[model samples]
Target: MAEGGITVTIDDAEVRAGLARVLAQLGNMAPVMEDIGRTLGNLTEDAFQASGPGWAALRPVTVARRGSAAPILQVSGGLAGSITHGGDATKAWVGASKVYAAAQQFGMPQGYAGRTRRGAPIPWGDIPPRPYLPIQDGGLLPAAQSEVLAILTRALESAVG
Candidate 1:
């Protein structure tokens, strides 16, 4: 079973064999994965820009890497604390990189009002969910998805041809 992100499986031995040959000729899968990642990165960046002000100002980062287990596609980055709305503030979260992002995107209780050790008031307050990741109808932009599919199809055709 695939443990990480997206997974592509080919059950046909012939197709798998062809793909293996093509991969061998290509020398590595990084280039293909990178191509896909770049496309997604561009779309994500565009979405962020179109979402609104705070999101528009953010920069997106896309990374594609081949791990021992599977290939990885990571798209991240944006104005970190830009989710703070009126009467809300940012906090130092000690969890996964996306914890705060999830909170901001999915929403959390509005219960943060206090001061730091230096006595500086923390504008911590309830944050409403402001989703910016999907950037479309609960998924990647249609055009972007089509482009990615075309890329994969081309790769497969090249391998089979």
Candidate 2:
């Protein structure tokens, strides 16, 4: 008892009950996160397909975090995946590493040296720009947004009601 005749004491039972409730709520979030991840993956894949062959080979991968169970959507494939979304040479990689993807997506210098199939040196002639990813506004994003919103709305309703 303190000055106001109020006493604060540790209640192990109450603490246990509160922890249980929190754990239960956390348990419910996994399925919702997984559903969201799948939906996003499908949407991204569709966008890639519509873009063109240059972007169609990429695939969407979803990974769930171990601590928070949050979902992360990523576009992945081999070397092609690096430059599909946008033209950049920063992430290009070969045996060691090189900046060639951007040259292909954008264009190489007039007389840049490149290799032939037989490893012979050849002039890197003019290469045309070919962008194939992140489909334009009238592409897959709008539909994906709607579907994702619907899924999240349902999840919220189920969780609350």
Give me the candidate number with maximum TM-score.
1
Candidate 1: residue 31 Cα off by (Å): 1.2
RMSD of each: 16.0, 21.3
lDDT for each candidate structure: 0.40, 0.36
Single out the weakest 10-residue window by summed lDDT for candidate 2.
Answer: 87-96
Off by over 4 Å in 1: 1-27, 52-99, 112-126, 135-144
TM-score for all predictions? 0.42, 0.33
Write down the TM-score for model 1.
Answer: 0.42
lDDT of 2 by residue, 62-133 (tens): 122223212111233332343221111111111101144343333445455553234433333354433322
